[model samples]
Target chain A: MLRIEHFTKTYRSKVAVDDLTLHIAPGEICGFIGHNGAGKTTTLKACCGILQFDKGAITVNGHSILTDPIACKRDLAYIPDNPDLYEFLTGIQYLNFVADIYEVSKTDRNQRIAHYGNLLGMTEDLTLKISECSHGMKQKIALIAALIHKPRLILMDEPFVGLDPIASHQLKNVMAQHCAEGGAILFSTHVLEVAEKLCHKIAIIKGGKLVASGTMEDVRGQASLEQVFLDLEDTL
Target chain B: MIRTLVSLRFRALFTGLIVQRQKKNKSSKGTVILFAFLFLYVFAVVAGMMGFTFYSLAQPYHMLGLDWLYFSMAGLMGLGFAVLGSVFTTQNQLYDAKDNPLLLSMPIPPRIILLSRMIPLLAMNLLFGGLVIVPATVVYAIFVEFSIVGLLLQLLCLAGIAVLAQAISCLLGWLLHLLLSKLNKSLASVLYLVVFLGIYFYVYSQAGEILTAIVMESQQIASILSKWVWPLYAMGMGCLENGGLLLAFLGICAVCFAAVYAILSATFLRSATMSSVSRKRQKLNLKTSKTAPPVNAIVGKELRKFLGSPVYLTNLGVGLLMAAALTVAGVIFREDLLSAFSMIPGFTDLIPLLICAVLSFLISTMYISAPSVSLEGKNIWILKSLPVSGKDILNAKLLFHCRMTVPLCGICGFVLALAYG
Candidate 1:
């Protein structure tokens, strides 16, 4: 569902993501594991057409993010780690704004918002101005808005940081349900346990390079995902 | 810690001129100089008006043996100018600052925090006050007397008046904060526009007679000042080497300032942390959900933003207001303007061109689209991540701008055309 081919992004002189390649098929959750400053965000932003890359291409459902951004973006949703959504809008207003952009039918958007908003326990809070919401509430709103259009691919960066344990479990279930419906998710996270338990394929990155990537058993071999991540980090 | 806070506040004020907040590199030397000249130009124009007004008053008051009254008048005008200039800023800095909660959470005392914020405002008051007082002193020296001690005393009195101005502004700003929280912010901006335009038109119409009138009525004005406002009387006298009255005027200013500061300090934390009036809650109903075209949605968003933000509305909407005002003014003075145009050799034939030129000037001031991206600030990601093209977004903003401005211009053009014809 998402293919990042030889993607190299640079900031002035320093390289952010260097000659990296990764692919996530439909019905898969690809956990992109990296430490701080490991170019995880750089790669994620490039894939979502939020950042321009210096080399190579990122494609979503066969549409190039650089050349066919609107088409690529129509098939995917990106929820950044901080959930910096529009504070001037009420939660439902923001959802409707996004829905309007994707041309989501009034009926479909209403049903999806209700379904996701209830699953995240955010139904009562949707009437409040986003500025008045807590960090966790904003995250839930972003999640609901992302799912409102029924995008085929989801690109999330640290999507669980501010969520309560119940919401986090619910989000895990949502991810599983999305993959079960043949939609793929490529998310970056530091929580190895969540990645180990949830991800069908795991890609470990160290210093802008893909250190190991494959099915869970193939990458971890008899060890845990945390050990493999730490071993990769120690070598750097 | 106070020094650090004050420096940060100053940096915040000069961020765009000295260095953009989004950029890491310093502003180019040319950009800095250009900004300096632009600011200086505005300051010079206002100061020049003050200088001229005082110049007109100086010799008349001196000949009438009302030198003390001359100084008192300048002090009063200076106080009014400074208070009006700084009141909105004081309200915003005190009540609406984004970092208030962050700083309030720190270990610093609330009073100290308030002091640091007020110190910059005091500096601004001094600058605004000086725009009037400095020009008055220079005219006074040129036309009346230039005694070294007297000049220094006038300056000292000016400092006291600036403190008084700051106190007045704080009180008024507090009132505005409370009032604005309850009312639509656009109303205050509209009031500001009306007052500004009212003064402008009155002066414009009476350009020849007003200064002469002030000169003619100098005695009555002087008497009113002396009998009703004794502090101003003392301020005037003190400016001319009356050390005792200077001390008295200074004392009154100091007392007023201290009382205001004490009262504000007691409630600084409470007011600073106060959120806007809480809105009544309403749960979302999916049954009532609706959608619009993407372009229309973007324009609706822009409209809401323009209305919600006072700065955005006033600065940009002034053009639309002017266009409306011109249409009304043109209708009212249609016969007079047509006669005036006939007096010009070729102007009658060029009426449409002239009207077009005037309306174009007004419409140019409507900035419905230009600042949209920059105004997004941290929310650029929402647009960047969305399925809409950048071109589509900008086109929507332009469409919104056109909808706001073009119809008004067309109506203005049509009405003036008919009225003139």
Candidate 2:
């Protein structure tokens, strides 16, 4: 569902992500693993049309993110590591705003919001101003908003950071269900065990270069995801 | 450590105002020059008004042998102006500063942090207080009497008045923060703004009459001050070369300031950390959600954001408020205004042109669209990841601005037409 090729982004003189290429087909959950400042965010941002890359191309659902951003953006949703939403908006107001932007029908939005908000245990808090919410609550609100429109692809950065254990488990189920329903997800995470279990494919990046990738079995054969990541870091 | 923190505060203030920290949006030399010119224009306008008002009062007070009253009046005006100008800033800097938690997490004492924060606020008081005192002093010297000792005494009183003003502002700001904690955020902010604007406009509209009364009732004012508020009487006398009274006045100011500083510092810890989440929470049920076209949805979001932020609304939205007020005033005082305009030679025929010019100037005061993009701040990714195009977003913002202003302007124009024509 998402294709990234030769993606290179530089901030002034420093190269953030250099010539990175990766892809996730429909019904696949790709776990993107990397160290801090390893260009995972830059690649993800480029794929979702947030940051314009210095080099290379990324396409979402057969539309180029750079050339036809509107169409590409229509099929995807991105959630950043920090859920810095509009503190002025109530949770439901923010969700309805997202629903409107995606042109979700009133009935469709109502059902999806109820389902996701219930699963994340956020229905009661949805009327509270986002400024009053805890970090985990804000994360749940972000998750519910992202799913309100049912995009073809989802890009998440450190999606499980501020989630409670139960919400995290529910999110795992949600991700699996999304992929099962023919949607794709490219998510970056530090939790190797979660990535090992949840991702159908694995892509390991070190210093903006993909070191190991493919199915979980192909990337971490005879070794755990954590050990392979550490070995790659030490060797590089 | 205090000096370092104070300097960092100033740097932050400067960077936020004049310089764009992002490398991609580095402030150009032209932009800096433009901002400097704008700053100078505002200062010039304020100073010119003070100079004119004080100059008129100087001759009358000198002729009446009420020079102490003149000096005392300046002292009082300086204190009032400084307190009003810096009170809100003091509240924002002391309690609602973004870095309060960050600073508290470090090894610094809360009082020390409070002291450092107040230093910049004190400097602001000095600038505000100086604007009045300096002009009063200049008018006193040129049009009244200029004594060497008197000049030094006025300068000393200037410093003393700034301290008094800063103390009052700190107290008022602390009270305001406490009061605002109990009320809704936007409501409290709007009320604060309305009170401030009401005071400003009332003072401006009645300035001529108030000046006449001050000059006419100098004897009664002098008697009341000496009998009841003798420190102010001492302040006026000291500025006229009375050394003993000057020392007493300065001492009173010092003691009062010390007492206030003690009280503020004692409560700084608790007050600064006061939680603003005192509002009752409401349960969410989206059974009646509605959808709009993509562009209209963006515009709706823009409207919510505009109304949600008091800072944005009060600052740029003043033009809209003024436009509506102008229409009501125009209709209410139509006869008086027309008669006054007719009295001016050849000006009556140009009323429509004049009204249009005034309305245009007011409209130009609002630049909501420009700041709307930058104000997205950290949440900019939400817009970028949305299906909406950049052009669509800009148009939505522009549409929102039009929705706010166009109807009001049209109504203002239609009513004013009946009033003038």
Interface RMSD of 1: 1.5
- Taking all chains together, the TM-score of candidate 2 against the true structure is 0.94
lDDT of 1 by residue, B180-247 (tens): 87776777877876797788789878966977877888888888888999999999999988999999
Clashing pairs for predicted structure model 2, backbone only: none
Measured against the true structure, the TM-scores of the candidates, in listed sequence, are 0.95, 0.94
Fraction of true inter-chain Cα contacts (below 8 Å) kept per model?
Answer: 0.79, 0.88
The residue pairs found clashing in candidate 1 are none
- Model 1 chain B weakest lDDT span, ten residues long: B274-283
Each model's lDDT: 0.89, 0.89
Question: Which predicted model would earn the best lDDT?
Answer: 1
The DockQ scores of all candidates, in the order shown, are 0.73, 0.77
